[model samples]
Target chain A: MTEDTKKLLYVMTNGPENPDKTYAPIYTAALSAAMEIDTSMYFLMHAAELLKKGVAETVALKKGGSLKQFINMALENGVKFYVCEESLRDLCNIEASDVIEGVRVVGTSTLADLALDADSVISF
Target chain B: MRTECSREWDTEGELMAIINGCEIPDELHYYLEGSQMTWIRLDGENATIGLTDPAQTRAGRILHVRIKAAGTSREKGKPVATIESGKWAGPVHFPVAGTITRVNEQLELRPVLINDDPYGEGWIAQIKVTNQAEVAGLLKADQARTRFNEIIARDNVKCIRCQK
Candidate 1:
């Protein structure tokens, strides 16, 4: 990445329960990465539930394609995936091993740092 | 009609094959990544690149395009542009390493040019070659025809050009 390469952070708080709200953030993050921005998606609160291996595979919008497809698109474009550790362990009752691949589990402090360092932050 | 220039490598006036209604021009080289198709035309030390007819058809109607500016250097397999269409959105990868010399500015106004004339007016970028060897292995017309035919059948694609 160049010095001028912008950093973008997308925070998703919705999960499988809100399938309508799930796709846009990951899709936008993928597009941002394709634009050569250093883009990342952070799944906080219930959002971490979608990261569970089988959950995303079954989640899809009415139009078509599962949530895993968008997740793969984001990962393929070099977008970083992060999940809130507390949400994973306490809220979702899932271990780090239960989530899909290519995700980093991090503490609340990391999200704070990411929000501070990011050039732009969007929440969903 | 756009007039053609006479060059040994130019495929204009050649009887391009229509497999599954997709035009595969003779002599133009291609790069296929999964189902995505990109083509490269070598001109001395420079190369012109764009999506193939089947790729544009598969993408449906393009809505937006963002190309890297001229003078930007990109490695082979890196994106030269990001295109969004009704059905799909992603990067258009560079077939060979080079510094971009030009981008199709017309796309900003008429992104559907990608659907209307993917091989001609919709050409994406011109590159000044930094490594000639990387251009050597791209699939030529006959080779690409075989592959595109398989993909067309497998994906059940029937190419349709948008009316101007």
Candidate 2:
């Protein structure tokens, strides 16, 4: 892949329940936006839990700043969020109806394909 | 103040080691300062290791630290640890072959400790070196700086934190 097309970002880890671990996806998405790249956040493993609409809000209420707000900002700025179907089933134990709006449930094969296709694949 | 470009060696005073352009605080001693990379040599038959200042700056805030357990034998160039920052997670190869004796438990509490104090509290692992001869293959402070500059130039790495 060409350097220009290498903008996709993959995040396979869970969002922070603690304050210290909060910067990973936050700064990463911000950096991608700064670079003006076509950013994609792939939620897999324990990471799929972040896509639950109320979950971010709940964490925000506890932490003071809205994680949902940050996610919304990313979404409004054109960050594509994808939830892995297999991970959602196995790890999250959730059905399609349980997820937040605007999330696309995709197979594990798609993740591999995207990783291979993207010019750069960064996992947090 | 102007930075000196001259390559002059200070052969008079006591040897103060530096790593990747950053001063290795007097409390710490250099174990393996190979090229642009440097690993902290911990005390005892087992030694703890981690990235140096220049490395942490280039990589950004560390997010995750994946390590192997005690008793596992590892080879040089083999990934002894895997660290993830904001954008990347990759293997950190060792300079010497050894068996892992201990891993820093502090990393589980705060992985950013690696970025916070790489030379101090953020040490990665303790290894019992199987071959002490590999220690001779490493570099020192002055050489490390030159090699680091070369690497940044070769990779075309723009320093986002510090403007070149």
RMSD of each: 7.6, 15.3
TM-score of each model, in listed order = 0.82, 0.45
**Taking the tens digit of each residue's C-alpha lDDT, what string does model 1 give over B54-78?**
8887666788999999999988888
Where does model 1 sit among the CAPRI classes? Answer: acceptable
| Per-residue accuracy of model 2 over A1-124 as CA lDDT, tens digit each | 1266557766657653553444457546644543345678788886777777577665543323456655655564456788898888897787867888877899988888777766688887
Off by over 4 Å in 1: B1-20, B33-36, B145-160
Quantify all predictions' global Cα lDDT against the true fold: 0.83, 0.61
- Candidate 2, true inter-chain contacts retained: 0.04
On DockQ, the leading prediction is 1
